[model samples]
Target: MADEETKAELREQFTEAFEGADYPVSNPMDLVPALPDGPGTRFEAGDVSFTAMELSTKLSDIQDFPYDDVETLVDDLIVGLDEKDML
Candidate 1:
């Protein structure tokens, strides 16, 4: 399990890295590209584009993990969105 401090640090790092890129429109159906051999989503939002790899990497690193649950999480999110008519 990851401690709170480590998680916070990772979150900060991830936000910093992604803040430099464009974000995708708030579309639930948007299909973001995956990072190379990494667990992340890349998309363009307005004038800012971002890669979510940093967040994945940070979380994995803090947990000392090599695998991520991103796919599962995304699937769950999609299901939830669909149920709520957000997708």
Candidate 2:
């Protein structure tokens, strides 16, 4: 399990990157454009690192589309990472 500090750092990174998406995104592809390096954007903390593409594909089932805001989307992403033992 990731420590609180590590998780917090990861969350910050995710929020900063993902917050650029136009809200109310209806699908995973909507997030790709918001990424700094598109799908290649990589997020890392401790021993965990994954590209935006990997996050989208690997956690697809955990993601609920039509996200109303960045906060909710980021929350789900972090929760998915935790549930998958990746954070």
Candidate 3:
């Protein structure tokens, strides 16, 4: 499991990257344009790393569509990751 600081770093990275996405995104693809490297955008912390596509796959079941903002999406993402022991 990731330590608190590592998780915080990952969360910060996620927010910064995802914040550039166009809001009210109806699907995962809607976030690609904002990704620095598209679906290949990578997030890393501690010993963990995941590309946008990988994260999308891992969190698919927990993610709700049509996100209005990055925070809510990040909130769900963090929860999903936590539940899955990905963070």
Candidate 4:
């Protein structure tokens, strides 16, 4: 399992990734096509569609941190999606 520190780091990264104007203040789902495949699922934001795997990868690439806390990461991701109006 991932430690609390790892989970927190992921959360911070997620928040950063979803911030800013070019980041699509609305939803990207309405922009992109369909998702590939992975855990969680696919979501839409305005014009962008993001697969669970894609989102995970983006978060992973943001920081050098590691997290074995799948649940925590998933939960934070869901919240991030909603925050970005993708849910």
Arrange candidates, best lDDT first. Answer: 3, 2, 4, 1
The prediction achieving the highest lDDT against the true structure is: 3
lDDT of 2 by residue, 1-87 (tens): 999888888899989998989888999898888889999999998888999999998899999998999999989998999999887
Which stretches in model 3 have alpha-carbon errors above 4 Å? none
TM-score for each model: 0.31, 0.95, 0.94, 0.32
Model 3 clashing residue pairs (backbone): none
Clashes within 3 Å, all models in order: 6, 0, 0, 16
Query: On residues 1-87, what C-alpha lDDT tens digit does candidate 3 reach at each position?
Result: 779888888889989999998898999999999999999999998988899999999999999999999999988988899899987
Q: After superposition, how far is residue 83 of candidate 2 from its true place, in Å?
A: 0.8
* Candidates 2 and 3 compared by TM-score, better number: 2
TM for candidate 2 is 0.95
- Model 4 residue runs over 4 Å out of place are 1-49, 53-65
Candidate 1 structure quality by residue, lDDT tens digits, 3-29 = 445434444443443333224423212
